[model samples]
Target: MSEILFITREPFAIQGNSRPALHIMPDAVYALVVTDPSLDFEENRAEPGYGTLLYKAPASSDSSDEETTGQTTLHRFAFTRKDLRSTCTEAPVVLKLLEIAKKLKAHVLSDYGALYFRDENGLVNVTEDAQAKSYIMGDKGTRYALTPDGALADPASLPAYLAENDFSFLPETQAEPRAEQPQHSEKPEKPQANSHAPAAPDYCKGMGTLKCSLFSRAYQKNVQLSINAYYAWCLSFLSGINCGYQDFPEQMLRYPIYPSTSNEDIAFLNAYCTRNPDDPFISACLALRTMRLERQ
Candidate 1:
């Protein structure tokens, strides 16, 4: 089994003063505690010094010995003045604690009691929250705060927004029935070059109705439209991509179409509305799509 080093806060003797500490549990029997010198009962807070490591004895069923309740000093570790004020993950003392965990081949448990790992960029949170994972993975384009109707919304409104939207267009799990094959093997006929061909399907047929001004106003306030205009546009945009009408970047397409809106999309719409308030929302979406394609 892998070991774990926990970073937590311990209260000082002085009121309202707390310092970061490290707790390591080698086994179920005993635990180790490392505290800053400023938290020492004999030391003055104004003049902090080296940190101390203590060994906590295991609990006993019988309260026969008084020494079992006390901790024994194991060793003293050197630290700078900046380490005294360390509290966050990037702090000096916290970095030292990470080094210690590295030496022991253990994982660093955050103050929230969740496991975390550090990289070249910074600390990465390992949790079940999708938004938190996206933020840590440098995918800020998936963190938009707009509702389906192009209205601003808070995080608390997500559940209600999701409840109101209809997602019946998504694929079903049950396999569809297959058509029976023809008994006869007939050769296909080729069409004449001069013959008129059928027109291509119109993927973006119903879009370009909502005015940019109305969208901007709705985005400024928490207004809901009678219809889900933004969702309709998203469906149209996705259809355009599927039908090869829109040439969006393959890399950017990895991000989700719904629930994850790009701030760049909102910004482009806002700027286009500032320039052409009477223009349709679909015009801004097309322009943004063209700009993204040009960037590639």
Candidate 2:
């Protein structure tokens, strides 16, 4: 499959760097400023969107960027501090973002955030170095809202500009910074695998088996072996079996237990248990819903 690398940074900084991560594909490289997280999932996507590749959130729910008034759906990728730098002129949208970042604060970038592109032949190649460019430029659209120094005339205009461009680069809104992924040291730390004192059976652990089966069945048809065994516990749920899915690691329990997500198992809990969160069972149900079952 054709894939592109995303060299991204949360702090559009001059020194900190990140490795090139694979992205599925590129959007309109010509559109000056297109969407990131892609406009397709600005709301959040369960599956790839059809046609234009954008997906809509459920009618009943609000968008990831829902406004206080409940009228506007905030765009997810608009004007993020986490900037993307690409040497491709085809990436006009990115050019616009860099210009805006400079205007916001003249923090000349330091470490190169490079994305290596691989064509159909599967030959990985370093296509460009962002440092090669002299000055990052923005599209003409930015001129309309600029002050004498070229920053947006009003803070509101930034949001408006973001809306017009479909939050392609990133939104200017402030969000609670997400926790950083824990980093491991150069030397691997060895651990005794099965050192736990054994877990007691509860609805959450028991129902994890159920999800293992259901999601596994759904996953099998989809053909993703990585998450297959988790379904075994879920399968236990299907047959009305009651046991802690954690007990047997291979088929019964496993290494690298995944954190559970309440959103995923919402339906099964509503059907089999309670809608009220006050119920401990409901809380446990939440734990098993989207738990990865096994580590990546």
Which candidate should be chosen as best, given lDDT against the real structure?
A: 1
Error of 2 at 162 (Å): 28
Residues 1-296 of candidate 2: C-alpha lDDT, one tens digit per residue: 21222223222222211111111111221111222222332211221111122212222233332222344232223221233332222223233334334333222232343433334764433434543322212222233323323244365655544433332232123232557535654664552121111122453554342432344344336554533443444444533422554454333322332333322333233322221222333222333331222111
**For each candidate, what is the lDDT?**
0.36, 0.30
In candidate 2, stretches whose alpha carbon ends up further than 4 angstroms from where it belongs are: 1-9, 12-89, 92-206, 210-214, 219-296
Consecutive 10-residue window with the lowest summed lDDT within model 1: 25-34
* lDDT of each residue in 1-296, candidate 1, tens digit only: 22233532111111221211122211100001111222211222333222333222233232211124444312223222212221234233345555444433334454344545556776543443322322110011123243323232365743443332211111121123656545688885653221111122345355456666777776567354522566457446745565673363342434344433444455445544444456666666654553443223
For model 1, what is the C-alpha lDDT against the true structure? 0.36
TM-score of each: 0.26, 0.20
TM-score for candidate 2, please give it: 0.20
At residue 147, give the lDDT of candidate 1.
Answer: 31
Task: Estimate candidate 2's alpha-carbon lDDT, on a 0 to 1 scale.
Answer: 0.30
Lowest lDDT sum, 10 consecutive residues, model 2, at 21-30
